[model samples]
Target: MRPATVFLLSALIIGSLEAKPNIKNFFSKHFFKDVYGTIDANIKVGDAGKPLILTDLIQQDQIDEAQAAAEVKLDAFLGVKSYAGYLTVDEIYDSNLFFWFFPSQSNFEKDPVILWLQGGPGSPSEYGLFNENGPFFIKDNKLVLRNSSWTTSNSVLYIDQPAGTGFSFTNGGYAENQTKVGEDLYKAIYQFFQLFPNLQPNEFFIAGESYAGKYIPAAAYTILKKNPSDEIKINLKGLAIGNGLTDPKYQVMYADYLIQHGFIDPKSRDALKDFEKQVVESMNNEDWDQASNQIDVELNTINGLTGLSSLYNYLENYSDESDDGIGNLLSREDVRRAIHVGNTDYGDSAVYSYLSSDIPKSVAPLVAELLEHYRILIFNGQLDIMVAYPMTVDYLQNLDFVSAEEYKNAERRKWRYGSDVAGYIKSAGNLTEVLVRNAGHMVPADQPEWALDLINKFTKNNL
Candidate 1:
């Protein structure tokens, strides 16, 4: 997050066009510079027209919710039994978080409910909802139901977090660290269960990509901290992270990953050694902001030296990299009215700025703590260069957990999706990691069928 001024975890940078328009891109680092409109000189967010409670939004009248609601703006009252509202986290500052909920598309009512989060320390979870595995995708300027959306069998909830990103609003208040971020989400999610008592029994999950790697594990850890019978029981089941930035200490090994993939000369490894040394020093000193800055520079330096256009994925140039349409759709008066937000902006830079120092701090220990009781799924795209598969394995292998040796010596089994060898699965105890074949940073967007297969199996304890 020290890249607060340098880079963003939203999407990898893109230059010009490529041969095929297939890859997805996010806001440029410079994009948020101008996007910072007003920083709340004086405001009362509680009275700012944001919905306080939304138990009534999900009614017997609404149909084809969530994926259906966002697509058809007409009568866009609700999504497949969907609900959209804000949860006030800090009453003193009046900071609030926005969420969009979707019901299970399956006939069964006891299906699990998964909460999808997006990274950037500031990125909205809508990226996963609209682009990767949402119930609907925007095709040819139209909203169409996605064939393999995770929502088909399970309820999905997409949230705009940290009180400044997307539709979330704040008045001089924001999270300063991963623990605060997790606490804010925990309060909101706990309130969520209170509003929808019907979903209390359905197993729940926390899933996301990129910077969310930090947000998710921290949230799961918070779930454990708050689960001491203080409130409604969150039948918590598991977690899933794709190409996450969990342990920067282990993941900062760009030189090793590059050499293994033939992206850099082995001789250049000597020059890159300084970057690693500096990052380690920053981590040792506990100056997380400095470490984050050093890591950003290191990646940018390598990307420049190698002329790699898109660091997230090496398979394509800037192809289908855009969420502009989703932005436009959300801005429409009808869409805002449908979702219950009255002209709230998306991509607030303040959220990223607030979380600047939290980027480099490792959530790996949080993962280790949760490993004792939960089923953890950490999968990454094979072609992802940002958080490479090797980097993920590196940390998981060395993670301080009960099944360290067992997981280290565990065999990697072949996994399939209808005869197509989709990926490789490695598991020991409750921890499961997979290397999705032919996928880049966005695994669900590139190989959705397999992504669905992975989650369905993981939640069902079938993996």
Candidate 2:
């Protein structure tokens, strides 16, 4: 094998716990530029003089001083208590994941803790915070409160994962697969609980969008399998995914979906169908990169033929505007100091590199496993051609879950936000699917009230 390929393989192998330091060092030097920072295993002590942490289910001896010392005051915007900082993923060459958390507005003890992840594999959860369900958004370089933010009823946590997204960074390398990513998250979360033990007992729910469809399941499975038997178990209630790209191979049925919805003519539909056949064939042959390329080509062709606007939401026009104004705000020295991420770049290449790699396949099994222990809420914004509603339905129907048939034939009722018709929901057993109306790929950003309702219901096990 070529030197570069071997180096990547070596890095992957050494990411494991069993790998010796010397071998890890060799790969770190060859593959990753050393990150310039102090390794701070910042562990706060309790009255007993012991590290005030939970069970040793997670290996967190290498916690770095990524914790923000800045006292972030968001009372003017959110009128709620918030925390932002980084937690280093151990033994993996500068793999530090950053997190921003908001305590529940109603009652911290009474409300569930919801962990939100963003897609792109490399995408930062801060986008979800500012652009979606967080307490506030950045508008014209200032904080604007989002009244329907999920934090109204749930303690929300947003994490930038895989060591290179958003505020998170790595000098070693990015995570290559779902399993390793899960390990890093599991450990980081455990350490997060160590810092604030009070939140540990609150019921926990994991949710995300797009690529997070693959991540949420793996991370949840890791928590389930790896939690120390005698230690305090995370009160994991359920999992939710919105417009997620769970089964990429099957979810590539976007062309058929669009055609069914009358976006393309019969001839054009048939042509795209033929192209889709080729894409599926490529996937069957395990040429994932080729299959991805084929889908992109097909989708772009359809967009051209139909004159469709945004793939994220067909009902709207696409705009690359920095209207949100988060970049400028986060880059400010005062803001960084207040948030304790002093001088750290908000978004970086380490994140995108991780997303460019081959994705882990068939997370349906992990979803199935979670169903046995907790309920699963899968929803989509109907207008999202990217990871559209039909694609999510297609994958859910194919899962090997016990009540697949019941769910398939279940009645889809009209879901509501007060008197307004928000969307539709079909549920059976532990699986529930909702078709969010008039929303896009980022449902929370498009329909914040509806999105907040969804979370409140899911976290409470009401839906």
Candidate 3:
């Protein structure tokens, strides 16, 4: 269980006497800055009692147990190094963020480093690790090697960020917006590279899904802005977002999506059209709170009638039973101790905290800014209603960037995985978008082989 003080601190920062605080309000941004200044004089160091850095907070980097439990071939672990531990972010409040690193199976020195963040703004990247593209998957009652995992050729780093996320914990106040989340992650990555210097020279990419759409661009922008010199650079190569919610206005194409898919009756579509109109009006008037609430009400109404099937994926039956099992596995005394979680509970708090904040500003501008130098891959599953593929294209088509015309006019090539048609890719210059067929919001899990191929292509700068 989390301490009462943590909630108290969070409330003080986010829940002021003001009703519906605007994200642009000045008070919140500088509240911590004023109190802590640029640096805190009373800050505490790591367990070694040395000056704080990324490596100091590392409690464990053992590959033996996790590899043995994963049942991977001995040769696989020979080149790969897995590190799991808490990296202290706030010494004054004892905020420690947890991370898991899986070096590439190919070449640690040359393989690209992919930093993977999951959606929910709170979902632990471990879900991506185990269920999506991690080195192992839980089967029967043990960890089993996942053959089509993303770690096959590239080094993957998964961190539970914004604090108070799975395995990661914080006694300090939580971040209230995407900007703050980006700053925190920027610091984490800086410390991450500092801890593992060998990865400094390798190609790196920031990739995620859903809410991470907001996170990836914001963090990438922050990294670029902060590190302008080659003396201490991030070697960032590109970015990838899969079924992401980068632009809510464009991403929420439910009315058209539902009507086209026959998920709603004509009468329901009419009602949805009315609600969407009101949402647009509110958004145009800059009443974000009203716009968000109206959209939420509309979504809930649609979901209430959609039956028990997952909103994320219409084709599959949704069951949260796996999350519980994974939680229980991670919460084990031995597991916690091995990962150096100590007494912190493994759960999701970052989601609620982020959602409770004023609606996230659109990440469109951020992505637009990133397109100047870095390659951007935007892939979406055809069946995803939670940030539909059409919505993603709508926003991308509207982006103001250097090669805008080239990207807009590019021919979409047909892509295949084995004998089946995998997806269609439209690429021009640095920006590309792919529509994965028969998949849903979690594309990697739904189409592992295709997802791997797409990622490998993007990382190699071939797409």
For each candidate, what TM-score against the reference?
Answer: 0.85, 0.82, 0.82
Model 3 per-residue lDDT tens digits across residues 1-463? 2334433433343233135433233222211011101111111222212211233433254334333332212232333357666566667667667787888888888999999988765677777887789888777546778889888899999998767666666675477777777777887787777667678999999998877788888889988898885346998889999887787777665777787887866656666666567656666777776655555545555555454256677887765333644554565445544444545655564544445433424778888889887999999999877778887888888888887899889998999878989999998778989999999888999999999999998998876
User: What order do candidates take by lDDT, descending?
Assistant: 1, 2, 3
Clashes of 1: 10
lDDT preference between candidates 1 and 2, better one: 1
Off by over 4 Å in 3: 1-80, 229-231, 358-360
lDDT of 1 by residue, 1-463 (tens): 3332222221122121122122222123321111112222122233233443342333332333422433323443324456677777777777788898888889436999999988776777777787899888766656777889998888998998878877888888888988888888998888777666678888999998888889899889999988986658888989999888899888878887787777766555555765577678779999776666566656665666566667777877743334555765666565666677765655557877777677778888899989998999999999888788998899998899988899999999999888799999999988999999999888998899999999999989998
Give the whole-model CA lDDT for all candidates, comma-separated.
Answer: 0.74, 0.70, 0.69
- Which structure among the candidates has the greatest lDDT? 1
Clashes per candidate, residues 3 or more apart or on different chains? 10, 1, 0
